[model samples]
Target: MSNKRRRSIFEIFEEYFENLEKWTERFREALIEKPSWDHRACTMEPLSNIMVTPTEVIVTSDLPYAEENTIHVKPVSEDTIEILAKMKRKIRLDDFGITHYKGGFQTLRCQIRIPVSVDIDKMEVRFKRGIFEIRLPRKQERDI
Candidate 1:
């Protein structure tokens, strides 16, 4: 008797969408359905883009289509400040669409450790152009 092998269904269909671009889209959608924690940022890094200068440190974040009063900032320690934001989810179909109530809560909380202690008394925070900037003064240095 002669030996014979049969190909599985997948082997036949593999040639149908042989292009890399066509297959890549399906692969990407499959990955999004089950998102992983790696999609999130590190805990220590600021929630958004930030810049620290010699005189002050600036932190910026953008939350468009968000109410002004939904943001909260708290000082956890002498050198750390935590920011928490709650944004309203939007619905394109209706004002109270089904999608709006589903996963309507969005939270971003991160503690920023300043290189120098911020003087809460003189601290300044500004929210403009969907950017939140916190200006903290540099600590005074004492000579030896």
Candidate 2:
């Protein structure tokens, strides 16, 4: 007999949902071409990325000139987290020669959705060299 492993139906279902969630996130991002800066809020959406590993989901963002003490990462829901940080100095659009938009900003804000189940209580955060990192341990699955 050929040696091959078979997956259980529950495993298959779990995989399907995980893939669907990931695809949904990708599709939403691809469909929405939002500006990086919000003039009314005076906030900039910094560059961010998410990575899922077998043990944890890690999210990282680039927040240059951000004041470390003013950074906050809070879980707004089971699968959503909000990140906000205030910069040390205001950034004027005119400084970049954008005369049409006259505004100064000094904050960075972003909301992220975790693709997999994670233990938010055990989440860890670190900011260094203008890079912010968040690590949330994956919740252990209990067998049915």
Candidate 3:
């Protein structure tokens, strides 16, 4: 018979707790820092969601009016990533019923903090239909 091992109950619980902690941290960040336009210094905050798995972390954002060629994703640190995207057309404050701010914005900028360390070099980014998706592979621990 082939040798196969199943994870123990304790191991499963450990994994569940780790995931819970990670999601709790993310929820805290979201609540502490509102992603509204005013909180973002007049820049529009694109709605985003993050999903973490044992192998990778997936980040997705809704970037309306942004062009694929103008999108950029960079890993700022082991647990942070910066995203910038330029809109195809300028969005003026007047468009949002705010005439006092007499200027327009053409770019969107935001930073996302990952819950776990990731391999930036292996990260993959894709933009399609005004949506941006990023997949970052989790760093493997070396047993020494």
Candidate 4:
């Protein structure tokens, strides 16, 4: 018969707590937002999702009124990317029943932080149906 010892109760509880801490950190990163000077004048936060895989990280953003040609994506840092999208038409605060802000905005901006190192030069991006997707390949150990 093979000899394999089962984990003790304390070991199980320790593993559980470790996993909980990891999950909490991931959740916090996903929900964190970077404040911008123009945020107060912005009307909407386009929903976004970041998916991390062994080989690459994919970031997708929903920009309802944005034009495909005006979308721009660039790496702000080794672990951060910036997105700028221009709407086809201006969006006024008055449209949302706020009269205090007189000027209209025609752009949407967002910044996303990736958890791992990525090769910015090899990144791929796509924009279709007012949605933008960015694929960033993880840097290899040798590249670092």
What lDDT score goes with residue 113 in model 1?
70
What C-alpha lDDT, on a 0 to 100 scale, does residue 137 get in candidate 3? Answer: 92
Q: Name the candidate that leads on lDDT.
A: 2
Candidate 2 residue pairs in backbone clash: none
Candidate 2 vs candidate 4: which has greater lDDT?
2
Q: Give TM per candidate.
A: 0.51, 0.77, 0.69, 0.67
Pairs in steric clash, model 3: none
The clash count of every prediction, one per candidate, is 0, 0, 0, 0
Question: After best superposition, candidate 1 residue 27: deviation in angstroms?
Answer: 28
Over 4 Å off, model 3: 1-35, 38-42, 100-102, 142-144
Error of 2 at 68 (Å): 0.5
* Candidate 2 C-alpha lDDT tens digits along 1-144: 978789899999999999999999999999877888998999999999999999999999999889999999998987899999999999989989999977889999999999999988899999988999999999998879
- Alpha carbon deviation, residue 65, candidate 1 (Å): 3.7
lDDT score, residue 106, model 1?
43
lDDT value, candidate 2, whole model? 0.93
TM accuracy, model 3? 0.69
> How would the candidate models be sorted by TM-score, starting from the highest?
2, 3, 4, 1
Q: Rank the models by lDDT, top first.
A: 2, 3, 4, 1
Candidate 1, residues 28-58: lDDT per residue as tens digits?
Answer: 8877444211213311122466677877777
TM-score-best of 2 and 4: 2
Tens-place lDDT digits, model 4, residues 3-80: 988899999999999999999999988886443226355545577889989899999998888888888888788778
